[model samples]
Target chain A: MAKAHVYITYKNGVLDPQGEAVKDALSSLGFQGVGDVRVGKYIEIEVEKSAPDEIRGEVEKMCQELLANPVIEDFRVEIPNGNNNPQPPKSEA
Target chain B: MAKAHVYITYKNGVLDPQGEAVKDALSSLGFQGVGDVRVGKYIEIEVEKSAPDEIRGEVEKMCQELLANPVIEDFRVEIPNGNNNPQPPKSEA
Candidate 1:
Protein backbone atom coordinates (compact mmCIF):
# COMPACT_ATOMS: atom_id res chain seq x y z
CA MET A 1 0.00 0.00 0.00
CA ALA A 2 1.00 3.60 -0.50
CA LYS A 3 0.40 6.52 1.75
CA ALA A 4 0.00 10.20 0.97
CA HIS A 5 0.73 12.85 3.53
CA VAL A 6 -1.08 16.07 2.77
CA TYR A 7 -0.56 19.43 4.38
CA ILE A 8 -2.96 22.30 3.90
CA THR A 9 -2.17 25.79 5.09
CA TYR A 10 -3.45 29.28 4.69
CA LYS A 11 -1.79 31.22 1.94
CA ASN A 12 0.96 33.58 2.97
CA GLY A 13 -0.17 37.12 3.87
CA VAL A 14 -3.52 35.88 5.07
CA LEU A 15 -4.62 36.38 8.63
CA ASP A 16 -5.53 33.25 10.52
CA PRO A 17 -8.35 33.89 12.91
CA GLN A 18 -8.46 30.39 14.31
CA GLY A 19 -4.81 30.61 15.23
CA GLU A 20 -5.37 33.89 16.97
CA ALA A 21 -8.30 32.49 18.88
CA VAL A 22 -6.23 29.56 20.07
CA LYS A 23 -3.47 31.86 21.13
CA ASP A 24 -5.86 33.92 23.20
CA ALA A 25 -7.29 30.80 24.78
CA LEU A 26 -3.84 29.63 25.68
CA SER A 27 -2.91 32.90 27.26
CA SER A 28 -6.00 32.69 29.45
CA LEU A 29 -4.86 29.25 30.50
CA GLY A 30 -1.64 30.77 31.86
CA PHE A 31 0.80 29.89 29.12
CA GLN A 32 3.01 32.93 28.64
CA GLY A 33 5.98 33.69 26.38
CA VAL A 34 4.25 32.28 23.33
CA GLY A 35 3.80 34.35 20.20
CA ASP A 36 2.82 34.21 16.54
CA VAL A 37 0.49 31.25 16.25
CA ARG A 38 -0.37 29.79 12.88
CA VAL A 39 -2.58 26.78 12.34
CA GLY A 40 -2.79 24.48 9.32
CA LYS A 41 -4.15 21.06 8.44
CA TYR A 42 -2.56 17.64 7.96
CA ILE A 43 -4.00 14.48 6.48
CA GLU A 44 -2.68 11.01 5.70
CA ILE A 45 -4.27 8.65 3.23
CA GLU A 46 -3.52 5.04 2.44
CA VAL A 47 -4.00 3.65 -1.01
CA GLU A 48 -3.93 0.06 -2.14
CA LYS A 49 -1.40 0.60 -4.90
CA SER A 50 2.19 1.92 -4.82
CA ALA A 51 2.76 3.65 -8.13
CA PRO A 52 4.12 7.17 -7.67
CA ASP A 53 2.70 8.61 -10.86
CA GLU A 54 -0.76 7.22 -10.22
CA ILE A 55 -0.66 8.20 -6.57
CA ARG A 56 0.47 11.68 -7.43
CA GLY A 57 -2.38 12.10 -9.84
CA GLU A 58 -4.83 10.81 -7.29
CA VAL A 59 -3.49 13.04 -4.55
CA GLU A 60 -3.57 16.10 -6.74
CA LYS A 61 -7.07 15.30 -7.77
CA MET A 62 -8.00 14.70 -4.19
CA CYS A 63 -6.54 18.01 -3.11
CA GLN A 64 -8.10 19.96 -5.92
CA GLU A 65 -11.42 18.23 -5.80
CA LEU A 66 -11.96 18.07 -2.08
CA LEU A 67 -9.00 18.17 0.30
CA ALA A 68 -8.24 21.86 0.09
CA ASN A 69 -9.98 25.13 -0.46
CA PRO A 70 -7.77 26.35 -3.26
CA VAL A 71 -9.02 29.88 -2.71
CA ILE A 72 -7.55 30.30 0.74
CA GLU A 73 -5.47 27.22 1.35
CA ASP A 74 -2.38 25.90 -0.37
CA PHE A 75 -1.48 22.25 -0.10
CA ARG A 76 1.58 20.07 -0.34
CA VAL A 77 1.72 16.30 -0.79
CA GLU A 78 4.62 14.03 0.12
CA ILE A 79 5.26 10.47 -0.97
CA PRO A 80 7.99 8.89 1.10
CA ASN A 81 10.70 6.64 -0.41
CA GLY A 82 9.42 6.55 -4.03
CA ASN A 83 7.62 3.31 -3.18
CA ASN A 84 4.26 4.48 -1.93
CA ASN A 85 4.58 2.01 0.94
CA PRO A 86 4.66 4.31 3.91
CA GLN A 87 3.57 3.44 7.39
CA PRO A 88 3.44 5.19 10.70
CA PRO A 89 6.39 4.46 12.91
CA LYS A 90 5.82 1.68 15.41
CA SER A 91 5.61 2.57 19.06
CA GLU A 92 7.19 0.50 21.82
CA ALA A 93 4.04 0.58 23.92
CA MET B 1 18.71 29.29 15.70
CA ALA B 2 16.22 26.51 16.45
CA LYS B 3 12.82 25.52 15.15
CA ALA B 4 9.88 23.66 16.59
CA HIS B 5 7.31 21.72 14.61
CA VAL B 6 4.15 20.91 16.43
CA TYR B 7 1.28 18.75 15.25
CA ILE B 8 -2.11 18.72 16.88
CA THR B 9 -5.01 16.43 16.20
CA TYR B 10 -8.11 15.16 17.84
CA LYS B 11 -7.54 12.58 20.50
CA ASN B 12 -8.01 8.96 19.53
CA GLY B 13 -11.57 7.70 20.03
CA VAL B 14 -12.87 11.21 19.51
CA LEU B 15 -15.22 11.97 16.68
CA ASP B 16 -13.84 14.40 14.14
CA PRO B 17 -16.79 16.44 13.04
CA GLN B 18 -14.68 18.74 10.89
CA GLY B 19 -13.39 15.77 8.96
CA GLU B 20 -16.89 14.52 8.35
CA ALA B 21 -17.95 17.95 7.22
CA VAL B 22 -15.05 18.10 4.81
CA LYS B 23 -15.82 14.63 3.47
CA ASP B 24 -19.37 15.69 2.76
CA ALA B 25 -18.15 18.86 1.15
CA LEU B 26 -15.82 16.85 -1.06
CA SER B 27 -18.52 14.47 -2.14
CA SER B 28 -20.73 17.36 -3.04
CA LEU B 29 -17.90 18.73 -5.14
CA GLY B 30 -17.92 15.50 -7.20
CA PHE B 31 -14.86 13.73 -5.82
CA GLN B 32 -15.13 9.97 -5.44
CA GLY B 33 -13.01 7.33 -3.64
CA VAL B 34 -12.28 9.45 -0.63
CA GLY B 35 -13.65 7.41 2.22
CA ASP B 36 -12.21 9.19 5.24
CA VAL B 37 -11.10 12.70 6.09
CA ARG B 38 -9.45 13.74 9.32
CA VAL B 39 -8.17 17.22 10.00
CA GLY B 40 -5.35 18.27 12.29
CA LYS B 41 -3.10 21.24 12.91
CA TYR B 42 0.57 21.80 12.05
CA ILE B 43 2.78 24.61 13.25
CA GLU B 44 6.42 25.58 12.80
CA ILE B 45 8.17 28.04 15.05
CA GLU B 46 11.55 29.71 14.71
CA VAL B 47 13.40 30.33 17.93
CA GLU B 48 16.50 32.37 18.54
CA LYS B 49 18.60 29.64 20.16
CA SER B 50 19.65 26.06 19.25
CA ALA B 51 20.13 24.33 22.61
CA PRO B 52 18.24 21.03 22.58
CA ASP B 53 17.11 20.88 26.18
CA GLU B 54 16.14 24.52 26.30
CA ILE B 55 14.39 24.29 22.95
CA ARG B 56 12.46 21.24 24.06
CA GLY B 57 11.31 23.03 27.15
CA GLU B 58 10.26 26.07 25.13
CA VAL B 59 8.37 23.99 22.57
CA GLU B 60 6.54 22.08 25.25
CA LYS B 61 5.68 25.34 26.88
CA MET B 62 4.44 26.71 23.57
CA CYS B 63 2.32 23.68 22.83
CA GLN B 64 0.84 23.62 26.29
CA GLU B 65 0.38 27.37 26.24
CA LEU B 66 -1.19 28.27 22.87
CA LEU B 67 -0.60 25.78 20.07
CA ALA B 68 -2.99 23.00 21.00
CA ASN B 69 -6.18 22.40 22.86
CA PRO B 70 -5.32 20.08 25.69
CA VAL B 71 -8.99 19.35 26.30
CA ILE B 72 -9.86 17.97 22.87
CA GLU B 73 -6.63 17.79 20.95
CA ASP B 74 -3.46 15.75 21.40
CA PHE B 75 -0.15 17.04 20.16
CA ARG B 76 3.33 15.88 19.18
CA VAL B 77 6.48 18.01 19.10
CA GLU B 78 9.33 17.17 16.79
CA ILE B 79 12.86 18.57 17.07
CA PRO B 80 14.54 17.85 13.77
CA ASN B 81 18.17 16.59 13.96
CA GLY B 82 18.26 17.38 17.68
CA ASN B 83 19.64 20.79 16.74
CA ASN B 84 16.41 22.74 16.23
CA ASN B 85 17.65 23.93 12.84
CA PRO B 86 14.89 22.42 10.73
CA GLN B 87 14.06 24.26 7.53
CA PRO B 88 11.66 23.75 4.70
CA PRO B 89 13.19 22.10 1.66
CA LYS B 90 14.24 24.47 -1.06
CA SER B 91 12.22 24.53 -4.25
CA GLU B 92 13.88 24.55 -7.63
CA ALA B 93 11.69 27.37 -8.80
Candidate 2:
Protein backbone atom coordinates (compact mmCIF):
# COMPACT_ATOMS: atom_id res chain seq x y z
CA MET A 1 0.00 0.00 0.00
CA ALA A 2 1.15 3.50 -0.79
CA LYS A 3 0.28 6.46 1.37
CA ALA A 4 0.44 10.20 0.70
CA HIS A 5 0.34 13.14 3.04
CA VAL A 6 -0.92 16.41 1.61
CA TYR A 7 -0.64 19.81 3.19
CA ILE A 8 -2.80 22.69 2.00
CA THR A 9 -2.09 26.23 3.05
CA TYR A 10 -3.46 29.61 2.14
CA LYS A 11 -1.63 31.95 -0.19
CA ASN A 12 0.49 34.60 1.51
CA GLY A 13 -1.75 37.54 0.71
CA VAL A 14 -5.02 35.86 1.70
CA LEU A 15 -6.65 36.82 4.98
CA ASP A 16 -7.11 33.86 7.31
CA PRO A 17 -9.85 34.75 9.74
CA GLN A 18 -9.69 31.38 11.47
CA GLY A 19 -6.04 31.93 12.26
CA GLU A 20 -6.80 35.45 13.41
CA ALA A 21 -9.45 34.15 15.77
CA VAL A 22 -7.03 31.63 17.23
CA LYS A 23 -4.43 34.34 17.79
CA ASP A 24 -6.97 36.52 19.55
CA ALA A 25 -8.11 33.64 21.67
CA LEU A 26 -4.58 32.80 22.65
CA SER A 27 -3.93 36.41 23.64
CA SER A 28 -7.02 36.40 25.78
CA LEU A 29 -5.94 33.14 27.33
CA GLY A 30 -2.79 34.81 28.73
CA PHE A 31 -0.30 33.11 26.39
CA GLN A 32 2.30 35.81 25.88
CA GLY A 33 4.66 36.42 22.94
CA VAL A 34 2.34 34.77 20.47
CA GLY A 35 2.62 36.29 17.01
CA ASP A 36 0.99 35.56 13.66
CA VAL A 37 -1.00 32.35 13.36
CA ARG A 38 -2.24 30.57 10.24
CA VAL A 39 -4.43 27.51 9.82
CA GLY A 40 -4.66 24.99 6.98
CA LYS A 41 -5.60 21.41 6.13
CA TYR A 42 -3.64 18.17 6.47
CA ILE A 43 -4.77 15.10 4.65
CA GLU A 44 -3.49 11.50 4.71
CA ILE A 45 -4.39 9.13 1.92
CA GLU A 46 -3.88 5.38 1.59
CA VAL A 47 -4.07 3.87 -1.82
CA GLU A 48 -3.83 0.44 -3.39
CA LYS A 49 -0.30 -0.86 -3.72
CA SER A 50 1.66 0.85 -6.51
CA ALA A 51 5.02 2.43 -7.19
CA PRO A 52 5.62 5.57 -5.12
CA ASP A 53 6.19 7.65 -8.22
CA GLU A 54 2.98 6.44 -9.79
CA ILE A 55 1.04 7.10 -6.61
CA ARG A 56 2.46 10.59 -6.44
CA GLY A 57 1.31 11.34 -9.94
CA GLU A 58 -2.17 10.04 -9.20
CA VAL A 59 -2.40 12.04 -6.00
CA GLU A 60 -1.26 15.17 -7.77
CA LYS A 61 -4.04 14.76 -10.27
CA MET A 62 -6.48 14.22 -7.44
CA CYS A 63 -5.34 17.40 -5.77
CA GLN A 64 -5.72 19.37 -8.93
CA GLU A 65 -9.15 17.95 -9.61
CA LEU A 66 -10.68 18.16 -6.13
CA LEU A 67 -8.39 18.42 -3.13
CA ALA A 68 -7.12 21.99 -3.44
CA ASN A 69 -8.53 25.30 -4.57
CA PRO A 70 -5.82 26.78 -6.76
CA VAL A 71 -7.19 30.31 -6.55
CA ILE A 72 -6.15 30.87 -2.94
CA GLU A 73 -4.45 27.75 -1.64
CA ASP A 74 -1.27 25.85 -2.38
CA PHE A 75 -0.69 22.17 -1.70
CA ARG A 76 2.37 20.06 -1.08
CA VAL A 77 2.50 16.27 -1.08
CA GLU A 78 4.88 14.00 0.88
CA ILE A 79 5.19 10.31 0.09
CA PRO A 80 7.17 8.48 2.74
CA ASN A 81 9.69 5.91 1.52
CA GLY A 82 9.57 3.53 4.45
CA ASN A 83 6.64 1.41 3.30
CA ASN A 84 7.74 1.53 -0.27
CA ASN A 85 11.24 0.25 0.39
CA PRO A 86 11.78 -3.00 -1.53
CA GLN A 87 12.68 -6.00 0.52
CA PRO A 88 16.02 -7.70 -0.13
CA PRO A 89 15.67 -11.06 -1.88
CA LYS A 90 16.67 -14.14 0.09
CA SER A 91 20.07 -15.58 -0.89
CA GLU A 92 20.18 -19.15 -2.20
CA ALA A 93 22.70 -21.42 -0.45
CA MET B 1 12.14 34.65 16.00
CA ALA B 2 11.05 31.08 16.60
CA LYS B 3 8.38 29.36 14.54
CA ALA B 4 6.20 26.35 15.31
CA HIS B 5 4.20 24.03 13.14
CA VAL B 6 1.41 22.06 14.78
CA TYR B 7 -0.45 19.16 13.22
CA ILE B 8 -3.75 18.12 14.74
CA THR B 9 -5.11 14.73 13.74
CA TYR B 10 -7.95 12.49 14.78
CA LYS B 11 -7.14 9.82 17.28
CA ASN B 12 -7.12 6.28 16.05
CA GLY B 13 -10.62 4.68 16.07
CA VAL B 14 -12.29 8.00 15.49
CA LEU B 15 -14.65 8.02 12.52
CA ASP B 16 -13.59 10.63 9.98
CA PRO B 17 -16.66 11.50 7.94
CA GLN B 18 -14.89 14.18 5.96
CA GLY B 19 -12.32 11.66 4.89
CA GLU B 20 -14.99 9.20 3.88
CA ALA B 21 -16.72 11.87 1.82
CA VAL B 22 -13.52 12.63 0.02
CA LYS B 23 -12.93 8.96 -0.71
CA ASP B 24 -16.37 8.61 -2.15
CA ALA B 25 -15.92 11.67 -4.27
CA LEU B 26 -12.66 10.34 -5.61
CA SER B 27 -14.28 7.04 -6.57
CA SER B 28 -17.05 8.84 -8.39
CA LEU B 29 -14.60 11.04 -10.19
CA GLY B 30 -12.86 8.02 -11.78
CA PHE B 31 -9.76 7.96 -9.59
CA GLN B 32 -9.07 4.32 -8.90
CA GLY B 33 -7.23 2.51 -6.11
CA VAL B 34 -7.85 5.17 -3.48
CA GLY B 35 -8.20 3.74 0.01
CA ASP B 36 -8.42 5.03 3.56
CA VAL B 37 -8.42 8.84 3.84
CA ARG B 38 -7.98 11.01 6.89
CA VAL B 39 -8.15 14.77 7.33
CA GLY B 40 -6.83 17.10 10.01
CA LYS B 41 -5.56 20.57 10.77
CA TYR B 42 -2.20 22.22 10.22
CA ILE B 43 -1.30 25.40 12.09
CA GLU B 44 1.71 27.69 11.74
CA ILE B 45 2.68 30.15 14.42
CA GLU B 46 5.35 32.84 14.55
CA VAL B 47 6.35 33.87 18.02
CA GLU B 48 8.41 36.59 19.67
CA LYS B 49 12.11 35.83 19.64
CA SER B 50 12.91 32.95 21.97
CA ALA B 51 14.76 29.67 22.13
CA PRO B 52 13.26 26.79 20.20
CA ASP B 53 12.74 24.78 23.37
CA GLU B 54 10.97 27.63 25.08
CA ILE B 55 8.83 28.25 22.04
CA ARG B 56 7.88 24.58 21.90
CA GLY B 57 6.76 24.65 25.50
CA GLU B 58 4.69 27.77 24.96
CA VAL B 59 3.09 26.34 21.80
CA GLU B 60 2.21 23.16 23.67
CA LYS B 61 0.30 25.21 26.18
CA MET B 62 -1.47 27.02 23.40
CA CYS B 63 -2.60 23.72 21.89
CA GLN B 64 -3.90 22.43 25.21
CA GLU B 65 -5.74 25.63 25.96
CA LEU B 66 -7.33 26.39 22.59
CA LEU B 67 -5.95 24.72 19.51
CA ALA B 68 -6.82 21.04 19.85
CA ASN B 69 -9.55 19.06 21.54
CA PRO B 70 -7.92 16.38 23.62
CA VAL B 71 -10.99 14.17 23.67
CA ILE B 72 -10.69 12.99 20.09
CA GLU B 73 -7.78 14.79 18.53
CA ASP B 74 -4.03 14.43 18.96
CA PHE B 75 -1.58 17.24 18.19
CA ARG B 76 2.13 17.20 17.44
CA VAL B 77 4.40 20.25 17.44
CA GLU B 78 7.52 20.80 15.35
CA ILE B 79 9.81 23.76 15.93
CA PRO B 80 12.15 24.20 13.01
CA ASN B 81 15.77 25.04 13.84
CA GLY B 82 16.42 26.88 10.58
CA ASN B 83 15.55 30.40 11.62
CA ASN B 84 17.15 29.97 15.03
CA ASN B 85 20.58 29.07 13.69
CA PRO B 86 23.14 31.41 15.28
CA GLN B 87 25.29 33.69 13.17
CA PRO B 88 28.87 34.27 14.25
CA PRO B 89 29.79 37.88 15.01
CA LYS B 90 32.33 39.52 12.68
CA SER B 91 35.63 40.39 14.37
CA GLU B 92 36.95 43.94 14.01
CA ALA B 93 39.94 43.98 11.65
Among the numbered candidates, top lDDT falls to: 2
- In order, the B-chain TM-scores come to 0.74, 0.83
What does candidate 2's lDDT look like per residue over A6-38, in tens digits? 888887888999999999999999877788899
The DockQ scores of all candidates, in the order shown, are 0.29, 0.62
Q: Give each model's whole-structure lDDT.
A: 0.69, 0.81
> Any runs in candidate 1 off by more than 4 Å, and if so which?
A21-35, A80-93, B28-30, B80-93
TM-score of chain A of each: 0.77, 0.83
Model 1, position B68, has a per-residue lDDT of 62
The CAPRI classification for model 1 reads as: acceptable
RMSD of each: 9.6, 12.0
* lDDT of candidate 2 over B13-83, digit per residue (tens): 99999999999999999988899999999999998857777787788788887888877888878778644
**Which candidate leads in DockQ?**
2
